[model samples]
Target: GYILFGPADSLTLFSGLLVLMLAPEFFQPLRLLAQHYHDRAAALGAAAELLDRLEDLPDKAVQKHENVRNADPGAGIVLDQVSAGFKPGQPVFSELFLTLESGSVTALTGPSGGGKSTLLHLLAGFLKPDQGEVRIFGLAPGEVRFGWLGQQPFLVHGTWADNLRLTTPDASDVAIETALRQLGLGGLIDERPEGINSPVSESGAGLSGGQGRRLSLARILVANYDLILMDEPTAGLDPDSEVYVIEALHKLAVQGKTLVFSTHQPALLTLADHILSVSGRGQVLDTSRGGGHYE
Candidate 1:
C-alpha cells in the first residue's frame, strides 16, 4: 500500500520489493530450528519412557557358585519355612513347609491368581524366597538342569530337528524321530519331504499352537531330564494334543522321573500321585494325603 499509494522514490520501492522477496528466506533458518526442537523433544520423551520401563524391571539374579550342587537321586524337593513374593515384605506363600518325594508325579491345582506358578518358579530357581530354603534333589533350586514346559512353547525359524535340538544339541536323529513319534508328531514329520529336516514353518505357514507345544515336549523326551516341570501342560490344547501330552507325561513318570506340574484339567490331576490344592491366598492343601494343609 505504501509503495502504490504513498509517495515512494525508486530506491525505497526497490528496497521494499527486495525485503518482500527475502522475507521467507530470512525466516527459513528459524523454521528449521523450530522443527529440530520439536524432533528433539519427541526423542527425549521416547527415551524417558524407555528408561522408566527399564527401571521398572526386576534386577537379574546372579547365580552363586556355592548354590550349584549335583543332584541327589534319593532326596527330592523340599520347601521349608519358605516365604516368597514379587514385592518386598509381601509373600505369596509364607512359612510354607512342603515335601515332594523322588520319582513321584505331583500336581499343583489352583485358582488363576494362586501361587501355583510362584511355587513352580521357586522350584525352578526363577525366583528367590524372602526367607527359608527351597531344595530340589537335595540341591538348591536351578542347581541341576531340568526340563521346563511353559505355557508359551518356544520355537525358531528352522527345521523340526533344529527346534528339537535347541535344548539337546547332542540328541541323535533316531532319538529325535522317536521323540516326535511319541508326541504324535510322526504323521506331520512323515508328510514333510525332508522329514525332520523340513522347515517347521513351511511356505509362510507355521504349526498350530498345539503342534508347537507338542514339539516342545518332544525336546524333553529326547533330553531325558530326570526332573520335569510343566505349567498348564494341557491348557489351550486340542483333544488330540491333550492325549499326546498326557500319554507322554505318563511315559516319563514310568521312567522314574520326578514330574511336577500345575494344571486344572481333571485328566492331568488323575496322573498326579499327589494332588495339592493351592489357594489364592497362598494356602496349600494336600488333598491326596489325608487332606493335610501346609502353612
Candidate 2:
C-alpha cells in the first residue's frame, strides 16, 4: 500500500495557490478607486463654481410694449437722446439726438468704424440703445415696415431670380426683369443667356463686387418698403456703377420712400437732403447746405 499524503498538507497547498491568484484581483479595484478620487473631487469643485456664477447673475425684467398707433407710411424717424455701445463705459454713441423726416434722404457721414453701422443697427432695431429712444413711424423699430442693406450683400447658391424671389416669391418675370434693369443690371443680364435665371454662386462668387451689391439693392427695390436703410451701397462699385446707383437712389427718394444711407463718398453726400456728421463725442452736426443745425 502506498503511503497516504496528509489531507492537511494538500489543503494548505491549495489554499496558498488560491490566495496568490485572488490577491492582485482584490487590490485592483482599490487602486482604481484611489486614482479616480481626485477626478471626482475636481468635478464637484467645477460644478460648485458654475452654480455660484449662475446665482450671481441678476434676473431680467420683462415688460410688454403696446403699439397704440397704426402704421403710418409718411411717419418720420426720431432719435431722442440715444446712446449705445457693445460695452459699458466704452460707448459707441452718447446722448445723440436727431430727427429725420419721411420722404427725404438723410446721409450719415463719419469716419469708418465710428458707429455708422451701429447707428444703422439702432434704426433697424437689430440693436437696442443703452439709453434713449428710436422712434420710427411713431412706433418702435419692430413695429415699422423697413428694409436694410449692409456693407456686404447676402446671396445664396441660386439663380439671380431666386434671390429676388426671397422678397417677392410671386413676382412675375416682367417684374423681376424691371427691378434688375433699374439697378443697372441690364448689361449683366444681357451678358448671360440665362438672364435673371443665370446661376449665382453662394455669396455671389461668380458676380463682380458691384454686380453683387446691385443685386442686393434689387431685392429692396422689389420689396418697395416705406423706409429703406443702406450702409455703403457703393462701397466697391466703379465710377459708372456708382453713378447708376446714385440715380436709382434719387428715383427712390422721388417715389416718396424715406431713405437713410451711410456713406463716405462725396457724390452720395451731395444727394442727401440733410447730412448729419457724427462726431466721436456723440454730437450730430448738420452740415448740409443751409443746414447749421446741431443736436
Candidate 3:
C-alpha cells in the first residue's frame, strides 16, 4: 500500500506530468504553420521570377496592320537584316537576309546554341528582333498561318483522340485517322484495343520519343497551317522512325506547305530544298540546294 503524500505535493507532481503530456500538442500547430509558411515563401519567390520573365517579353503590336489580309497574296517568308538575341550586344544571328519561297522546304543547321531556334522564334512571332524585319506570307510574322513543332512537344493528359482534337476541334474521325496513318502512328492505334481512345499521360508518358514526335507532326497536319517550323524535328528518334518522319515531311512539302526546320541529321538535311549552315555569329556560312534524292 502506498503512503498518502500531502495534497500540495501530489498536486505538484501531477501538474508536472500533465505539462509534459500537453507540450507536444501545444507546439504541433506552430510547427505545421512554420512548414506551410516556408512553402508559401518558396512559391512567392517562384511567382516573382515568373513575373520578371513575363515583363521582359516583347510587346505585341496593338494595331490591326499585322493581319493576313494586309499582306501580299502569295505565301512565303522573308527576313531582312534581322538581328536578335536574348541579351543586349550578344545577338544569336546578325543581319540575316533569308528568303523562303512558298511551297518549299528549307533547313537551318548549326552548332548548339547557335540561334537556329531563335530564328524560328523570330519567324514564329514568339520573339521580336532587336533590329530588322520579318515577313511571312508578305505580312508580319504574326500574320502568318503557321504551326511550330518545338524540340519537345507537349502532350496534355488525355486520350489520343482528345489530343488531336485540340488541334482542330471539329476534325472528323476519318481525318484524324488519316493524319495518324500519314505520320506512321496508325500502328500505335492498331495496337491499342481502345484505339483512338487510348489514354495518353502528360508529355506522352506511354509513347516512345519517336512516337511522340510523330504524334506531334500528325497534330500539325490536322491544324493544316501554311508553314510548319520545326526545331530538331527528328531528334531522339530511332533510325526507322526518322525515315518515316522524313517521308511524312516530304509529303507535307509536296502538299505546298513551306517547311523550315533546324536539324543536325544528315538525312533530314538531305530532304531540304535549301540548306543554310549557320555560323557562330549567326550568319549563314553556306547555302546548298537539296539533292532531292527522296523525290
* Model 2 worst lDDT run, 10 consecutive residues: 60-69
For 1-295, candidate 1 gives per-residue lDDT tens digits of 3545656565587798999999999999999999999999999999999998777454422333333344685798899999999889779999999999999999999889798999999999999999999988888877776899999887777888988898889988999999999999999988888999988663225688898899989988988888999999999999999999999999999999999999989999888899998996878999995657898
lDDT of 2 by residue, 1-295 (tens): 6988566745687798998999999999999998799889999999999898777444411111234237665668888998898777888878777788888899988877777788888999988999899999888886676878887888988999999888778888888889899888998899999899999988687778887888888888888888999998888788877887898898898899998988989888877899988765666677888776544
Candidate 1 lDDT score relative to the true structure = 0.88
RMSD of each: 10.7, 15.2, 8.6
**Relative to the unseen true structure, what is the C-alpha lDDT of residue 161 in candidate 2, on a scale of 0 to 100?**
93
Query: Which runs in model 3 stand beyond 4 Å of their true positions?
Result: 1-66, 69-75, 289-295
Candidate 3, 77-168: lDDT as tens digits: 87888888888998886777877788888898878887778888998999998989888887877775678888787788998888888868
Kindly give the stretch of ten consecutive residues in candidate 3 with the minimal lDDT sum: 286-295
If candidate 1 were superposed on the true structure by all CA atoms, what would the RMSD be?
10.7
- Model 1 stretches astray by more than 4 angstroms: 1-69, 201-205, 289-291
Candidate No. with top lDDT: 1
Q: lDDT of all the models against the reference?
A: 0.88, 0.83, 0.81
Model 1: clashing residue pairs? Answer: none
Q: Cα deviation in Å at residue 202, candidate 3?
A: 1.1
Per-residue error (Å), model 1, residue 117 = 0.6
